[model samples]
Structure formats: structure tokens, C-alpha cells
Target: MAEALDQARAGRDAAGTALVAETRAVVAAAGAMSARFRSGGRLLAFGRNGGAADAAHVAVEFTHPVIVGKRALPALSLGEDPSTLPILGRPRDIVLGIRPAPDDLAVAREHGMLTVALTMGRRRPEADHVLPALSEDPLIAREIHVTMYHLLWELVHLFLEGETEA
Candidate 1:
């Protein structure tokens, strides 16, 4: 039990370090994302890794605003499949594709949408903003992505609400 706990702690520590490495990129991406939202663009998230949880998580967080007083933004999950995007996506919208398959990635680009990705490795060829997974362990990947997305949901407000760092 102690061994497992230690492993988990190490993984989390690594994930935090990885996130720190990506901090500047994340800030830039969030700035661009904030601009999109300001221009009446909505966020459309999709996952093709056999489940819709990632997309659902992103959509819900953006649409509902987990923090109090943050305005609810428009967002939707395109489900577990990728084909729906070509039909549903608009040029002004941003596509947050989670572990997208090649086909979905292609379709997303064809739609001319601003693309961001949360993935397990290097940025997929399709994602303009790619956040690589911090660890190879599946559990670590999940933990990192959840924390990353949640941080995104919270920090994005700073850009949108005109808050400056103290």
C-alpha cells in the first residue's frame, strides 16, 4: 500500500512539473481562446478514445462555470465520434479534440476551426494548441489531464475578465 501511494505521489509531482514547463504555452493558448470566446465563438470538445468523458468534462466546465460569478460560456460535446464535427462546427468555434484519431483530426482541420488538444504524447498533427500528457501511466495521464483542464477552466477567466496577475 505504501509503495502504491508513493508511486502515485511521484506521478503527481511529475505531472505538476510537466505542467509548469507548459505554463507559458498554456497562457498563450488561453489568451487566444479568450479572444475566440469574446468574438462570439463557442467551444466544441470531442474525444475519440472510446469514451465521451473528456469532452463532457470540458463542455460542462466551460458552459457551467465551476467557479462562482464566472459567466457561463457556450460549449458542447460532439460525442465519442468525430464525424459530427464537420457537420456541426463553425469557423468561429474552437475545437478541443481529446485523443482524436487521425480521421477526426483531419476533419477538424478541414472545418477551419481553431484547434486545441489534450493528448498523451506530442501534439497531434491537427491541434494548434497541444498539451502533452505529463506521464505515460494511464492513471497519471488522467490525473494530469483533469487537473490541466480544470486549471484551464479557472485561469481562462483571468483573461476574459481583464484580470492582471498580482
Candidate 2:
């Protein structure tokens, strides 16, 4: 029982520290994303299997903000549809790859879309922004991702309103 608590504490501490270190970058990314949104760009988030699930969560949260008085932003999930982005993507739009499959970032880059990749130490040069999960354990990675996306949602809104450090 104590071991579980220790592990949880360690995971949380590591995630918190990593996120703090990346706070400036996160805000910067959010600022750019907000600019795109203000210019009529939509956010396209996609992933496969577990990534797909995170994409769904991000889509709904961004499209239907739970916070009172927050504006609902335009966002959609690509799911498993390979044709979705090619059909609807614009240069001003943004793409987020949650544990994306091979070629995902390449495709988004080719379309000239702003690409944000949530990955675990995998260098993604095709992406404009790369946020690391910072954990090797799958469970820890999942928890960190949940926190990261939630922060992304909140920070995006804050950035849009000029209430953040962006």
C-alpha cells in the first residue's frame, strides 16, 4: 500500500516538474493556437486506439468548454478516418497528434497545418510543437497526458483572453 502511494507521488512529482519546466513553451504554443482559432482555424486532434480516446476527450472539451463564461472553440477529432483532414484541413488550422501513428505528422506538415505532437521523447521535427509525456510507465503516461490536455484546454482559453503568460 505504501509502495503504491510512493509511486503515485513520484509520478505526480515528476510530471509536475516537467510541466513547470515546459510552461513557457506550453503558453507559447497556446498563444499561436489561439491566434489560429481567432483567424477562423479549427483544431484537429487525432490518435489511434488509446490516442483516439484522448482525441475524443480533447475535441469535446475544446468544442464545449465546461467552464462557465468560456467561449466554445472549434475542434474536431479525426478518429480513424484517413480522409477527414485532407477533406477539411486548411493552412490556418492546427493538428494535434496524441501518440500519433507513423506518417501522421508528415501528412499534417504537408498540408501546412500547425502540428502539435504529444509524444514521449520521440523527436518529431515535422511538428511545430512537441509536448513530452515524461514518463515510461503507461499508467503514468496516461495520467500525465490527462493533466496535460486539461492544462492545454485551460491555457488555450486563457491565452485567447490574454489572461495568461502568453
Q: Which tens-of-lDDT digit does each residue in 1-166 have in candidate 2?
A: 9999998889778876886787777777787788788888999998754777888899999999888999999999987553577778999999988876657777767888888877754434457888777766666667767777888888888877874446
Q: What are the lDDT figures for the candidates, one per model? A: 0.77, 0.79
Off by over 4 Å in 2: 1-8, 80-83, 121-125, 163-165
Highest lDDT, which number? Answer: 2
In model 1, where do residues sit more than 4 Å from their true spots? Answer: 1-5, 163-166
Whole-structure CA lDDT of model 1: 0.77
Residues forming the 10-long window of minimal summed lDDT in candidate 1? 119-128
Q: For residues 1-166, write the lDDT of model 1, one tens digit per residue.
A: 9999998898878877888898876777777778778888888888766437978989999998756899999999988876777788888888887776655667666777778777765545567788767676766676667777777777778888994421
In the predicted model 1, the residue pairs found to clash are none
Q: How far is candidate 2 from the true structure (C-alpha RMSD, Å)?
A: 2.4
